[model samples]
Every structure is written in structure tokens, then in C-alpha cells.
Target: MCRWAADLGDAIFLEDVIAAPSHSLIAQSSHAREAKSPTNADGFGVAWYGDRPEPGLYRDILPAWSDSNLRSLGRQIKSGLFLAHVRASTGGATSRLNCHPFTSGRWSFMHNGQIGGFEKIRRRLENALSDDLFDQLEGATDSELLFRLMIGEGLSSDPYGAVSRVTSRVIEASRVAGIEPSLKLTAAFSDGEALHAVRYATDDHAPTLYTAAFAKRAGRCVVSEPFDRDGRIWREIPQSSFVTMTRDGTSIRPFAPATTRWALAS
Candidate 1:
């Protein structure tokens, strides 16, 4: 899994989520305490909305800590909405295209965790995509394929529902292929207006996923783990839940499972 962070305001400030003291994302790249693997040196990427109408992206096949360019860029850039990721490849080439913060039009997406049984079910998943989305599938990672599926499924209007449907389809397809798919997914997506995030797992015990909210009015910063004990308000997002934030405020909602039983049964 990768680490990422996004800030939304007059502009977006998205960067690789790597500001924590000890177990920060940068730290995890070297000595991960929770991941199945201890090192995430495959690559890193970041995207943030800038003064232009479109967001800016910076990606490289270099470890986050070792990349001086990213360090210099991080200090120089600031936006109201931004995204950053450090990758651990799951069968894709370690290249810039395979990095996170994949962008399409005004939308940007970054995912943590993997799609279980991806290789077995890749063809089935691809066949389900629309021509337009299929044409745009650039890299071969399960994450990119999943994003295209969401786009082809018309998820722009209702992102939450779209993601749930896509996940359900992948899981059902994997089952048909005689693979017990166990997905661990936590994602953040934005269309330059609102940001949506979800934490979910196919098995009950999914990979560790958490979210923290920071309120300027309340003068608090919440995170996956406590960054500081400055006596600010911070809380963990419940498992199998989704959160959406806009200019007004943030709202939490339950993740409604998709009705893919028939699809699986077929």
C-alpha cells in the first residue's frame, strides 16, 4: 500500500502523505510496521490543483526518500487540493505511468491496497468496460483498470455508488474464476470540486486503513495516526465507510454493498 494526503481550500494541496514524525509514509517506504511488505521503493507520484484549470502531476520510478526532486517540489508547491502516493508494485512495471494520482479530465484518483485475484479476473473486468474507458486504459495495474471500470460505469455523478458497483463486479468475477478474492481498498478521489474517500475490504479484516479530519474553525488536525497531541479534534473513520468533503463541510456515510449476486451467479 501507498501513503497519500490532500488538502482542499481556495486551492488544493495534494502530496504524498508523508509528514508524520515516526511512521510517516516516507518512513514506511523504508521500515513499514503494518504492511505485508516493509519497503515501498517501486515509485511515487503526486497531483495537485494549481492556478491552471487542470491539476499538476509529478511522478517518477524512484523511492520517495531518495528523490530529491520531489523534496524540492514539495516545498515549492502549495494548493488547496492535492494527492500523493508511494507505490509497492503488484505485478506492473515500475514506471511513471504506473504511479498513483492517475488523472482523467478534472478528476484525480489515488488508491491504497490491491485487487485480489486481479490476474485471474482481468479479462472479465476489461470486457465489462465501455469503449471510451477501454481506449484510455494506459497501464496494466489493477488500480488503473478499476478506475477505468468506474469511469465506464458512469461513476462521475455518484462516485460512491459507482465504486461500490465496480468493487462488487470485480469480487464476483473473481469468484467465478475460482478465486476467493479478498480486496483491501482505501481510495481518495476528487473532481476539482469535492473530495471523496472510502475504506473497505472484502474480508472482514482488511488491510489497515484510517482517515483523519482537520477543521480550521476547530483548530484541529485528525490523521490516520496522531501527528501531534496539540489537543485538537481528530477521529478515525469507521470500517466500511465513505466520506465526502466539499467547500461547506465533511459528511460520513455507510458503504452500501452492490447487488452483484446475479452477476456472480451467472
Candidate 2:
């Protein structure tokens, strides 16, 4: 969706994918078939990349469905590359800062799923981040923390490698805490050029991630569930896989974390 043809010659609107779809992000907020929390009423956020390197961000502690601005803005704003998230609290306080699609410089990220016992190891994970990344942190959610950790793990240069390293560390920490030792997640991140996503877990299930091409338009969309009623069009990413989407096309490959211990630079 990074082509210059924003909204693909005006056939698709932002809301058309976020709010209007049958199993849209708004619908998944209420009864997600694969999410840990069915009710994503804690908060919502959207990050859209425009001409600038950094993406524009909007977040509020309201369910996406209840947010009038979200609807209004979605209808008006047009972007080829954007990400919207409806959050269901999973061991984090409900607040604007705790929302998804956390931003750092030009990078934007959003996630679905949870760490088995985030509370027990949150501090450890936080401690691993460098001072600069720690200073940018404003929320206590594991999703934001993971973004920063990915940054610390070298997201700017090695996006998927960073994610894999961080996931390995988190799962190792959870095991030490006598928790489930699982890091179940489906996440997407971008640096305003191409979008990268991963679906990985130490458990039996990984949160669902799917992508569908526009029928009448010239864009692609990735979602937690099928964006439209016709599930046949959406292709689910395989478990433990990495996907990279660009103006050229999308590519998928097997994904897994680095088993080596992760130690951030001081």
C-alpha cells in the first residue's frame, strides 16, 4: 500500500477497511475470534504515513466504535500506508499512552496477543532498553515496551531480526518467572518505506494475521481477521512466519527468534 496512488485512485477509504468491513477492526474489538480479550474497549489508535518521515498519530482511551473523531477522520483522511489498532487491555492500564502503534522517530508499530506473564518480567524487559528508548517510553503496556525493545534490538537496520531477538528474551524471562514461557503475538511495523509483520509464539496458537488485495482498487491490506465478509479472499499468514509488503509485492518466509541471549548496548 505504499504506492503514490493514495487510496488507490479513490476507490478505498480508510474507514472502508477499519469500520465498514464485516470483520473490521471495529467488529474485532467486540468479539475477536483470535484475540486474548474479546472486548477491545480500552483504547484505540491510528498511525498514517504521509509525505513526512514520521507518521501522524491519533490515540484516545475510547473504544474505536465510540470515537466520533475516528470515524470522521477516517472518512476524510486518505493514505496509502496506515495502521489502526483497537486495544483490549492485557495487564496494562487503560490510557492514551498505553495505546498501540507506538511511534519512535519514523517507525510505527502495533501488536495483538500477549506475553504470558508480562507483569512479572516487565521491569526486566524495560531495563534492557537503552536510555534514549527508555526516555521515549510513556506507557506501561507490553506492546509499547516491545516496540522500544525491538528498537533497542536494532529495528532501524534489522526489523525482523530485532523482533526475533526480543521475543526470545521475553519468552526466556517468562520461563524464569515460572509463567507460561510463551510469547504469543502477531505484530506489524514499518519505517515509512515498507511494512513488516511477524506471527510467532511459543505456544500452540499464534494470533491470526491475514492480508487481502483490493478487488476494485490498487492497494493491499493486512488485518487480524478478514476485512470483509468473504473470508475466501483473505490469506492467513502461516504460524511462525515473517511478511514484508512493499509497492513491488509481498513476501513471506519462516520466522523465529534468536535463541542466543540478548544484551542491549549500554
Candidate 3:
């Protein structure tokens, strides 16, 4: 299992949200209240978009709760949009490169699910990427490859379409290979402007996701789980849906890929 938090709106310190909340992300790194994997101690990464076109990235193999550099940086770095992730290794080795919030150019992504039978389908997915994206692939995780696939699929222009097309391809490949639970995903993607997210799974049990509105800061946070237990503080994102959160507000829609899968199942 993996966990992620994304903030969009006015520039604010990262710790204010990830560390200061009642049941903060740092607290969840060791004792997650919602995910199947309680402790996400494999690694962590943060991608914060500041003045540059590309976001500043910091990833380490240390757990989020124990990393001093992360806490120090979180207090200083402020961004209108930023993403932080804590990873729980599904099966692969724990390495810094495998951490979430993978970045390429201006886009940053964090994911909380996996490609079913990834070891079998990894090659097929890699073969589908262009030479440029293939070279840019640094980590050996399904999430990184998926991010590259999205970039190749034109994430800069059509984020929803790109994610749908690539995810459909992955699920089809898994099906062709006789892989059960073809794909499960709850991801956040941003290009320094608006934040876009999706939750879908071939198994109909996609990972949990929520949007916590911060009226005081006048921003929004999309999290894998609510920071606190308060029901009113968080609004859950329904299964098989697409969400986009901008400075103005957030909008939700049914995700076509999951809809297509469910339609076929019925």
C-alpha cells in the first residue's frame, strides 16, 4: 500500500498540512488508520512547485516520520501546488528511486495502487513507451512506468484522456496475460497549475481518496485518507471517478475507463 497528499492554492508551508493536522500524514506513516498496509516505511518523496517550471524533488529511503531533512524542508518550502507521498513496497526492493511523486518536466505524480501481475506485464508496458520516456524511467515500480506512459500519452494537454488511454491499455494487457485484478489505482497528477486525480480498479475496489477543504487557507487538499477522523472535514471521492481541484474549486466526474469495465461486467 501507498499514501499521498496533494495541496493546491496559495503558497503554504508543507508541514502545516502534512505534519500539523490532528492525524497528520507523518503520523500515518507508522500507523495508518485506513490502508491495508499500516506502516509505509519503505520510502518517501516530495515534489513542490515553486518558481521554476519543474518542481523541486526530494526522495529518500528513510520513512517519512523519521526523516529530519524532510521536516526541515517542509517548514521552509512553500508552494501553490505540491505533492508528498509515503510508499509501502508491494513486492519490489526499497530504494529511493522507487519513491512516489515521480517527476518529469513540469508534471509530478503520486499513486496508491498497482498494476495486477506487474512482473508479467512490466515488459509489455515498457515496450509501449517511446524512446524518450523509456530513458526517463528511473524506478522499477509500476507507478513510475505509469507516469511515463501518461507523459507519453500527452499529460500536458489532456490529462484525463491520457490516463484513461494508458490505464485501459494496462488493464487489457493484464487481461490478455490472464492476470486477475488487472489494475487498481488512485492517483494525483499536477503540472504546477491545477490538480487532477482518478480512482479506479478492475476489481471494483479502488483505493480510498478524499478532499479536505481548507477555507482558512483558501485551498484544497486531495489525500489518500482523511488527515483527521472528523467526517465533516473530508469529502470522499466516489469509486471510479475523476476529480480536478483548482484555485477556484473542485469538480468530480465518472471515470470512463472504470465505467467501461463495469459496463462490460454487467
Candidate 4:
């Protein structure tokens, strides 16, 4: 997995910090200090909301550390909502269509981590998708499958519910395939108006996920990890939780498992 960030404010300040700091996303790609595998150089992507209602996306099969176009674009474009991702392919092909921050209609999504044993249950999962959504599939990645599943489950209206429902279905599919699913997933989705994120895992212990706020300090920013050691307000998001942010404020809530009926219906 690779580090990613999203920011929503008066203007977009999104960048693939993969190469910015001393221990940036780019550093993580080739020499990750946290994961067993130390490389995440498969591909990278970004999405940002501009004047239009829909978000704009940029994806490349190039390593973030070597992408000059990304560096140039990151410095020039600005928006109020944005998402960035650095990928290390688990079971997916190395293609731009399989990149994160996938967009459809007016929504955008990005994911971190993998769906363990995805190959075992991929057929089952695919069978459950509606023809309309199934036909739209452009890549063969579990992340993209999860996104489509959420959409088929009605994410446009209730994002939290859709995610929970899909999670439950995936878990069930894994069980039937005689394999326990290990899902270490941190995700963010937005519809140009509201932003939502979830940090979850099938195991009792999940991966690192954090959130922070400016507090009363002006011109300050919050992120996954502090830019520096100034941790006056940076806080870790609790395990198995979801967050929602808008112009008004941010909300933290428990992420409950979806009902059996809800999962099968969708």
C-alpha cells in the first residue's frame, strides 16, 4: 500500500506528495518502512473538483517519483475537493484504467490496501452485479469491482450504507469460497458536494488511518500524518469507523456491518 491524501477547502491544494517530503509517497513506493513489501511503483492517480459539478481525474501507469507531468499539473491546477493515490498492484493489471480515484457520473473514489483472496470470489461477486453496471467495467481490479458494487448498491443516495452493504457481501462471498477475506481498506469518495471516508479491515486490527484539523489556528492544514512534528491537533481515526466532511464541519461515526438482507438485495 502507498500513502495518499485528499483536501477540501476554498481552493484545491492536491499533490502526489509521493516525492515531496523526506519520507514521501514516492519514498514509500520503493522503500516502504511500514509494509512487508517495500515497493508501490505500479501506478498513481489524482482527482479534483473544479467549477463543474463533476470531478476531474488524472491517472498514469508511471511511477509517481518519475512523473514530470504530474509534478507540473499538481503545481498549476487547483480545486476545492481532491483525491490522490499511489498504487502497488496486488491482483490487478498495470493499466491506467485500473488506477484509483475512479470516476463515474458526478462521483469520485480512491482506495488504499487490497482485498485478499479476491480471485477466489471474483466470479461470485461479478455475478451479483447488474448488467448495466457490469457492462461499464473497464478494468479487472478488485478496487474497481468494489466501486461498481457500491454504485449498484445505491451509493449516490447513501454512501455509508452502500459501503457497509458491499463489505458484508464480499465477506460472505469469501466464506462460501472457503477462504477468509482480509480487507485492509482506507477509502475516500465524493460527489463534488460532500466528502466521505472509511477506514476498515476484516481483521480485528486494521491498517493506519488518521485525520486532523486546523483547530483555531489559521492557515494550518490537517492530513493523514503531520507534515512536521507539530501534532497539536492531528488525531488518529478509530478502527472500523467512517468520516464525513463538508463546509459546515466533520462527522465521525461507527461503521456497522450491513444486514444480510441488504447485502443480498443489492
**TM-score, structure 1 vs. true:** 0.87
Q: Model 1, stretches more than 4 Å misplaced?
A: 10-24, 215-232, 260-266
Question: So what's the TM-score on candidate 3?
Answer: 0.94
Which runs of model 3 end up more than 4 angstroms from their true locations? 229-232, 258-266
lDDT of each: 0.72, 0.77, 0.86, 0.75
Off by over 4 Å in 4: 16-24, 30-33, 215-227, 230-232, 261-266
Clashes (backbone N, CA, C under 3 Å), per candidate, total 14, 0, 0, 4
Stretches of model 2 off by over 4 angstroms after superposition: 1-12, 178-180, 230-232, 262-266
Comparing 2 and 3 by TM-score, which wins?
3
Give each model a TM-score.
0.87, 0.90, 0.94, 0.89
Q: Write the per-residue lDDT of candidate 3 for residues 148-174, one digit (tens) a residue.
A: 989987889999988988887787677
lDDT of 3 at 93: 79
TM-score, prediction 2: 0.90
What's the distance in Å from true for residue 73, model 1? 0.8
Per-residue alpha-carbon lDDT of candidate 4 for residues 1-266, written as tens digits (9 for 90 to 100): 65566666567445423345565555666666655466778898888888788888899999887889988887788677787777878777899998887988898887877789988888889988999889988888898899999999899999999999999888888777778777877788889887888888888666566665553332222234433334335567888999898877788899965867423322
Error of 4 at 91 (Å): 1.2
**Candidate 4 Cα lDDT to native:** 0.75
Best by lDDT: 3
Ranking by TM-score: 3, 2, 4, 1
lDDT string for model 2 (97-200, tens) is 98877898999988887787788888888888789989999988788899989999999999888998898889777766667786777888888788888888
